[model samples]
Target: MNRTYLTNIDTSISDVDFTQHKNAVFILHDQLNLDTWPSWIREEKPLLIFIESAAKGKTLPYHKKKLVYLLSSMRHFAIECAEAGFPVYYHSTKQHYDRALKDILSQYEDLHFTFMTPSEWDSRERLRTVISEFSTKVEEIPNNFFLADAEEYKERVKDGWLMEYFYREMRRKTGYLMDGEQPEGGEWNYDEQNREKLPKDHSVPSIAETETDEITREVIEMVEKWYSGHFGESEDFTYAVTRRQALYRLNEFIDERLDEFGPYEDAMAQGKYDLFHSQLSVYLNNGLILPKEACDKAEEAYKNGNARLNSVEGFIRQIIGWREYIRVYYEAMMPEVREANHFDFTNKIPEMYWSGETKMNCMSECLKPVIEQGYSHHIPRLMVLSNFSNLTETDPRELNRWFHLAYVDAYEWVVLPNVLGMSTFADGGVLASKPYVSSGNYINKMSDYCKHCDYKISKKTGEDACPFNYLYWNFIDKQRETFSKNGRANFMVNMFDKKSNEDKKAIFESSADFLEEISRYKKEQ
Candidate 1:
């Protein structure tokens, strides 16, 4: 049966009377709400339009699965809307956004079209421009998924855009760690406690496996067919696609692993894909799960004696602290924000990012999981892969695009703020206070990768030295002038100034060689 042809027979209003009243079109992805629809429908009885934009298809990389995931999810959402007493017009176009809108408007001459604001900057801007031509009113509704409403967050953080301050405020307001208005753990953050590396013999519980449904299986087939020439492996494409499944996964993480999540949240393991980390990001990003619900569940677990306050607070901070903060920062500084580049670094992304053949054990292992499973925990993403990209002076846009393409949870609204802003510091200091660059020592301390790596983690020069060691110094030397003015980077500048010119040159030359070899290996694959 062709699911696309399924219709709501009871609400089958005819095309003949479509132009009779003022119609408003609400554009929605699967991640958006239907409750947002009826209010608009009551106001105008508008023909709800869901478009799979050709622009998105063109802009995304060939190998990126985001297009397929988004389209299929939207299609599923559209089918649900049709069944729920709503008149929906679904359009899949290859070209001309105007053509689609014009065609729809021709059918309903007096249609006063309006759509909720898109989370992505590009989509929002494009729709805003196109909708300006219509004589009717176009109102953009506020997105309510976040705990910190945009206007409220902006007003609350008037002193500065610092995340720490904002996070503390949220903690106080929500009573996340409060014991009757006082902090429960005495300290506001357990960041010191959370940085412990996993013991060598530490055992991680097996990740739960999910079987793909027929719809998901079809989506996987479509991705394989269209994206065969793209980078990354095509196997084992399992992700939660609905709210119920996402909730189940969340519960399992809280009940089974939340107790240990705090102490080893930043630790990485060679063969482990999830080590005390919640892999619910893809679901949260796509609207399958809400942040509030995830946070509330963590709090509930803590209260029920299933988890510790440290673990629950740590988990809540990711959503309420970093995630919400990044979104607010993105909205506040976008359009101009995407163009920020403090170091003015413009090196091309090396091919090793696609093929996991690098000598850097952290990068190799992290990329392997990313290519195979379309996922990696936060620490690997922030500290390993992203750190390498920044240290090697890869073009922030290229690195940002690669991250957006490769990750299962990559959406522009989420990925752009994280990759360009937080991870890479490509947006200067607007998102992150400082660049997250680190030497091989950081990797060695965090994981067991250093033990098996051929390169010496302690060495800064010569053939046996880790590439990250040379790259770290080279990155600092290259960006000294840019970082000197930054108060947070003063210590790094002093360290760079201590190195002799000859030693600096040697590190620079070695980094160049490492980057070249990595690039060649990627092209060969």
Candidate 2:
């Protein structure tokens, strides 16, 4: 007789079972690779389960495209596992995770379960609850998906926790572009070379599009019916759903797009959605393309003389440096980090975020791509969307929620720090050295948005002026005490202090009128 002992760890409970099968493993959504499967479990060739549960779908109401992509990809992965001779169980049901685990456990008596640690806190805590309900022992294996481990980050981030130092350490550790303890070009960052605006009449590179198969089509329909009121479009889904397709897209990016990606990574244009970006964040976040794979591919392009050193270095830095750092930062600061609202902004989110019914061409332009495909590059997220939110004093938590719901690449681990820390400065100065607010001049200099907008970027006051101008000033004045102490932003505060009393008064009045109008925008939207 096989014996299974269930521990009453928390409120969650599991029924007793007696079965001969000894082990099984569960793969969470973010941990989709076979490499993450534990070695001890590999010896057993345990039953692999991927549950499609209601816990995710009903939690915060995700985008339709995001939902479809995950479900379709999981289904496709299950098929691949079966073909590879793994005993795979794909459960698609409308229930919580514990119920799905219960159903799986009921299939074989006395079967011990195992899972790779999740990439997120909420999911990890949820897993603990679910495992407590099972009579069999559940094993947790370490997640090795990231290039930098937690100890590496903790070791380096002791003094001030700056990203540049952490990033340089990763370069030294990975040896991606190391030249005898120095970076490839004797500089740690090629960001200066990567800021050139898109030249007029230059053609943007076209992105690789994946053909939707039967599985994707089925997912599309399922999202349409089940998630009717979700924030995204389900039709004409084009994301690569399998690891093979993701790898192919990664190669195509290296061969065709990597060279130009560096020079124009920060540029945003009138109708150009993706100028030279690989657009592989969704695949990277979903585990179809690992961070190591992306970094190696870009480095390969430079070694083979297909891409310039600046382009290759810039691209690789994003994956290994920024992407890896953000994940580590999210892990280090959580639970409390999620609710960090340093500015104490309480204003409701403007209706324009959802409807895109604004005269600001910059905001409208950014929203167009986001609404259509559930995607956009980093500049827009920082400059247009988050920049606007920061200047207006919109609730950081509110903006964070919108980001979590809107983007396909948004997992809590990625989205929370990028928003609370980097994007909105919601964590005060924890993630960013200074706030990232900018006037219309930065937008006009960076893109052609001002030339086509209704308001004049030159004007700093009144309704005909660019909203970013006064809004930018208003934020500086409003958060003067908070910002005046930081060296990176103190200069801007000095500039604001030097302005004449009349000019400052007019700027505040105009901002007040605009904000009042914004308060009424809910009815318009």
Candidate 3:
């Protein structure tokens, strides 16, 4: 006899079941955890579900390897779910979610279903509409992959969503950065300690390991075959394909590099991807590893004397501070959020973003890493590439698409908050108090990009001048009236006042020429 029951369920419960059908489907996103499937499996013994290339809304200009990486990762997760004794039903969807759901419902009439909430705002909205259309009830499961629930966290921090306050609350609640209710370190942040530039003679340690097993090898081969037309180099894809490999990478960072992570976290060096930087974001974002496990490992390293408090705090802040904050912020504002254009930017993105063939050394170096390896450190992302995009008046949506396509770890939920909000200030002031616009001087201060560039770093107007110098002031000058009223923009306005009208006009003309040249290349691409 078929039976169904609905019990008391809160949003925190990671699992739910509809007991009538013997067969059920668990729709899994690429970033969702497999453990959330057990409750549905135990009750209905239903088949599992997965969708390949689940990206909807727009077709992105992604590197071929990135496309393959996401699809292959989804396939691998499906295989593992099958091995765990769940009958799996997986399909690649080129249709929109509504069409895909209609197709699936048409095929399986007697199936009960449960789905972990999708990370992306659009996906969740689509699922809501689709499920409402079905006569049969569907259970929505909580996503336990995150350290805290999004809805709950939103309610908790509704009054003020500042990251510092939220981060402090998380540390207090979890005892992550605490010692008997006091912070382990006297200070909550170690920002002052984490700004050392790499010494010219400094040597970066060789990466811990690069060993891919049979599954990863097969995934890589499939990516190369299917996505050869995309922009990135296929030969440089060497990320951990499984949870085991991801753990190894994390442990290696905690053991060998975490102690120095804080002091050099923002430093960029030539031919170095891991100078006191954790390369585990690819794994964490892909669901191969959890943020809590990473945080715990870093904390353990501090206790074991393998790392320092500053490093542990800094690492934890990325997961708890930036990562969690971004996820919450994305959920709070989306759909409409994506359409925001505080700068009203209309300029096209440069072709060099796709080709990695820019004359600007910082842009070239940063884009080369992304094109070749599908990754770049955070500083290069915020300060170098995104900074330039903001200064050049590149459309935030276009820039957002480029970022989402370029990185292996890129997903709409994570990348949008970072790109549109923090990087570009496209959300006005919701994500960032001010745009992270900077000149070649800031780049020179942060990295050795100036030493290698063809232009004079200090010059603002001539042919041999740095592009960033002119672009930076031009951005400020163009947007001066908008920014003049913003409290956070007061410093930049004051800096603007220091320049004479002729000097500003000269910068504006130089910037116009530079942007025109970039626009020509964009059309060619």
Candidate 4:
């Protein structure tokens, strides 16, 4: 079945004049909503351009659900724009941005394009060059979608590159929890109290899921038919795709999940899937909800004494601090950051990563969520998926690619710094001070998944021993000289140095055996 699903609406190019259609507003799939539209954007009443770019689809063979989410959301937004008295030119084709824009320019003469600057470096650069060729005025608006603007980030980051420092700067700049010159609660960080594992009796709040309307159903069918072999499941596509739904989810998160969001923010458990983590990254990454708005809401809750300061501070840090910091980092070091592989790891990704078939319960559990829903909170991403990749010396590029393909919210700028820098330490401490490596003990402490696992968390060696235990030592030994330079990693390196040479040898052997077994499994698959 070689069929293509392209969105074609009524519009003609024959003898088109620029007098009537000179002004055009091009919207990317990620920039689905018009909430941040400038007065000029609304005043000009430009043609709303919604492109279902096939170049985007071919970029990574993204998950079917992700495809459905973006396309459905775009379709919905187009309908809204039409209802709002804007001429909507919706088109889908098997062409990249450059080609698509060229086609559009050909159809409509003397046209000027107004677009919110693309979030990705490549797209932004390409669009700039494309519009330059026409010699027409291209109004590239500043993206006010984020809380911290580019100028603000540049000024604050002049002091330091550390995330905590940047976070504090953001806190002060935003006045999120400032009492004049002091932080609220007299503490900069509340992560100390936010590390508890879930109590057995604790219950998770229900997710405020968006109902799939008719347009979304069409997209699902389109993706299921066209992207049949893409990464994730498409059947249960229930993500918030509009502004109304995203706001509802945000409010629900504050009312029900924000209190418990601080404590147990890092905790992972079996069948607890998302636990108390607010799954707004999907909405936030897209244009549905702005960071400042979300952070302001959390702060408002704390001011009203509705939520605790710890929870409020922690939640604000995620939105205004870490999320914004990563974007700044991505802009500072890209093109090079994309190719950064400090360890020069060349190992192939195991077949199990895609299949979600593994003996290790931690990896299995983590990968299963990604496979089923294209989501898993930050813990599993850093502690489990990237930890395993770092320990096994899996290629950072491969890990990064998998992340972009597998997750719904993944954009280039967001995914690169996280995967290449924080996750793999591939930039040699540009984004992370030290590698986020942990043994079975950390995973066991955080979750009950280890309790029912095939491997024993207590064991240090042998087939029954958890792979993470030996793999952690193997990575430390392998990168001993490199990691020994970092102050934070020195303690772990010193502990590994004190271990008996015999135990060290056994750890290396087990790691080797496991890697060989994984290779065999790869061949079998």
Candidate 5:
């Protein structure tokens, strides 16, 4: 007779049979790749569990497209796993994950549960509680979704933890663009060549649309019904929901957009939403495509002379360099990092972020794509959206929450560091060397937004002056000490000091009036 041990220590449960197979694997939404599973789990073909918890969706006012993408992709992956001869048990319920999991564990005798470690810190803590309660029944394996391992990051990053140093180390380790020991082309970065503005009237390649399947259509309807009050529209959802479609998108980007992606990487335009961006962050963050595969394809394109070295190197840096570095930063600085407020801003985010009703053309144009489709490239996100928030003195936590709720590709791990540390300077320059604050002249040089705006971009202070012009100077004047220590930003303080007292007074008055006006803009209830 096979002896059966109780999952929890209880003297009353002694008559259970151990011959029956009660092993199962729980798959999270982000861990959608079946190939990443351990070999024994794949061979045993144990029962697979997937949970679509309504409580998780209600945690935030998430973008409609984000919900639709996650749900449709998860349902499709479940269907694929079932077709691959796995015994699948999927729960679509209103209960939280813990409650639903407890029910499953109680229904079976000595049921053993195995799952990979969750990517999120909050989710991991919750799982820890369940593991403690279950004791002998639950086991967690290491997560394999990302390219770099935690041990690799720890081993490689020893000094000041600068991104360039870590990124160069990663290049050497992966040998992606290394020439023996040095970087290919004798340079570690091609970012200088990637800053050209888009020529006027330049035609961009049209975005390819994906044909929606029945499962996706069902998910769209469900998202519409459940998240009626969410921010974005689900009707224009064209994101790839499967690995095959994601791979197709990667190939399409390489063949069409990769050549021009580097030169105009920083350019912004009136109606062009994507420009030359790969638009694959939604898929990559959710594990539909691996980073190594994406980098490999781009490297192949460069080798074949289909794309330039600048474009290919820039693209590879995003994956193996910046993306990997951000994850490491997020892991090393969390739980306490969330509450970091170096500047101590307490104002709410501007109402125009949600309404798109600003007179500033750059803010309005950049926010249009975000409001309509839940998408925009990084330049618009950094220069326009985050820049305005920093100038207006919006609370970093509030801005971080907005980004998390607004973007289709955002998660806590990415958004927290990007917003509080880099975007808003909330962490006192932990991630950024200096605050990414700029005046209107930079925007005027980079895009055609100034040509269509109501305010004068040339004016530094007056009724017709661009708000960024006055607001930027005011920010510098107030935070002079912060910039005094920063070598890259100290010149701005000297420039502010050279301004006449009359000009300084005018800047303060203009910034104060604008801040007051925005503060009074209460959202329509």
Candidate 6:
């Protein structure tokens, strides 16, 4: 199993004269866009180097489907580069990246390596270590995969660190959904018009499945053989591996799902995993589709009257506003952000998260898609999955790793800010204003999950009560001082204060017992 899968096919040159072709471009798994190639690379057609480290793929017990998606995509891109008349040296190896690069360096003389700055912090550090050793041969450029300007973010964020301010600044800068100096439709955000629950009569568009070609089939077989006990199933692996397929999915989303995407963007339901949400994050996070291109297509849909402004604006906000802002936020808050634990919750993760077996209907429903397909829309992620974690005081770091391991779209840059900052409030109000914990009533209002649950949503205390009800109050009472400073969350603190002494005691006891139960469940597992 430690055997490496390495291949090198130089289409342009058969000879191995490293001094003749001194310039080379190295492609990472995430930076797969051909159009983003530098002018020198396009003109000179320098040697293309791709390293597929199996050791890197198994760094976190990554979902088997994620493994297939990433490795397949890399292989497909390598073929594309070969067809495009570039000499490719593709390395599929179980060896560490540094050692692999060292071997490559040993074989070549006066060969220089240029790569796009890696998206993840650890990847950057590893590259830095290699660059330090080969100072004359290796260099990197700023990653253009994202559209946010760090300088603009710093200038706009002087007033506050909120996303809205940064989002508006990006709107003005990009002129996306903008009319002259003001926002299109006289509004900056259409989120208020969104957030409607899924109606019974409403139908969801079917998610487009990518057909497995020979390369993907080979990858699935390799991943199954290599990663047997990883997270999610790889049997039904069907994700767009090439740029053409990713664009097709984007167009399909715009044509069928974009119009209704605004209203039901946050809605979740039983048996409906996608619900009007454009599952383009997988494409966006990887380099299959650029942010500007996707945003432009959505804007065109709005202009042509094919999609509503609310839907288009909402989709654009996710790209330019939240996604880009989070990238910048991650850059600003790393090393420290990784270890940020404000409430310092030391509890271990529950068994139910991995097994997807739980009496809680909402948690089970949300965790199902993640375990089966390595996907779930944003609402389920923020409300149900991370909500349960925060309520149970699970370590935010463990939950972050689970998100990275469980979701195909998860990268450290996106997952860390979201899990530690937004979801769990582990950064002490740096990424999110407050903890995103909520009772079962919110879940009931959003979806029909509570109506069929074992624990009564109406009950606020006792053994049969929904655990979220007591856990929310317990979190509020424990973090009263933090909530009191937060103007928006202060009302929840007042409500918890108004609870009678007996009710307070019942809430504390229920939360305590439930926490113990999950902890014991973890121990048993």
Q: Which candidate leads the pack in TM-score? A: 6
lDDT of 4 by residue, 133-202 (tens): 7656567777757766766565444334788988888888889999998998899989999999998868
lDDT of 3 by residue, 299-374 (tens): 9889988888888899999998889988888767767778878888877777888888877888888888888878
Output the worst ten-in-a-row residue range by lDDT, candidate 3: 1-10
| Candidate of highest lDDT | 6
lDDT of 5 by residue, 1-525 (tens): 111211111221222232355898889888898788799878988888888887888888788888888888887777777777777766677767877787778777578989888878887887777788887889989988877776666433322367888888889889997789888899999999998888999989976888887777877777887789877788977889889899999999999999999998999988888999999888888889988889999999988999998999999998898888777777777789889888898888888888888888999999898888788998888888998898998888888988998898888878887888788888888788899889998888778889899999989998889999999999998989999989999999999999999999999999999998884224431
Runs in model 1 with CA error above 4 Å?
1-25, 35-48, 62-64, 83-85, 96-99, 110-114, 135-137, 152-160, 499-506, 515-525
Evaluate model 3: give its lDDT.
0.74
Q: Ten residues in a row with the worst lDDT in model 4?
A: 7-16
- Give a tens-digit lDDT track for model 2, residues 1-525: 011110111112222232534667788777777865667655666677777775578787678889888888877776776667667656556676767777666676667788877888878887777677763566677777888887667544423488887888889999999999989989998888989999999977687788998767767776777788778688778888899999998998898889999999999999998889988999888789888888888888888899999999888888887888888888788778888999999887777888777999999999988877889999999988999988877898888988888898899888898888998888888778888899998899889988889999999998799999999999999999878999878988899999999989999999998887784123310
Tens-place lDDT digits, model 6, residues 1-525: 232332222332243345677888888899999677677787788888888787898788899889889888888888887788887777667766777887777778678888888889989898888888888888888888989866556444323489988889889989999999999999999888898999986878897888898777877777888888788898877789999999999999999999999998888898788999887999888899999999999999999999999999999999999999888878877777888888888877888888998888888899898988899999999998899888888888888888988999999999998998899988888768878999988998889888878999999999999999999999999989989999989999999989899999999999889888784235320
Clashing pairs in 5: none
Stronger candidate by lDDT (1 vs 3): 3
For all candidates in order, the CA lDDT equals 0.72, 0.81, 0.74, 0.82, 0.83, 0.85
C-alpha TM-score for every candidate: 0.88, 0.93, 0.89, 0.94, 0.94, 0.95
TM-score of 4: 0.94
| Candidate 2: regions farther than 4 A off | 1-21, 39-44, 155-159, 519-525
Clashes of 2: 4
The residue-level lDDT of candidate 5 at 251 comes to: 91
Lowest summed lDDT across 10 adjacent residues in model 1 is found at 1-10
Give per-residue CA lDDT, model 1, range 209-266, as digits (tens).
Answer: 6666665566566556655666666556556555556778888898889989999989
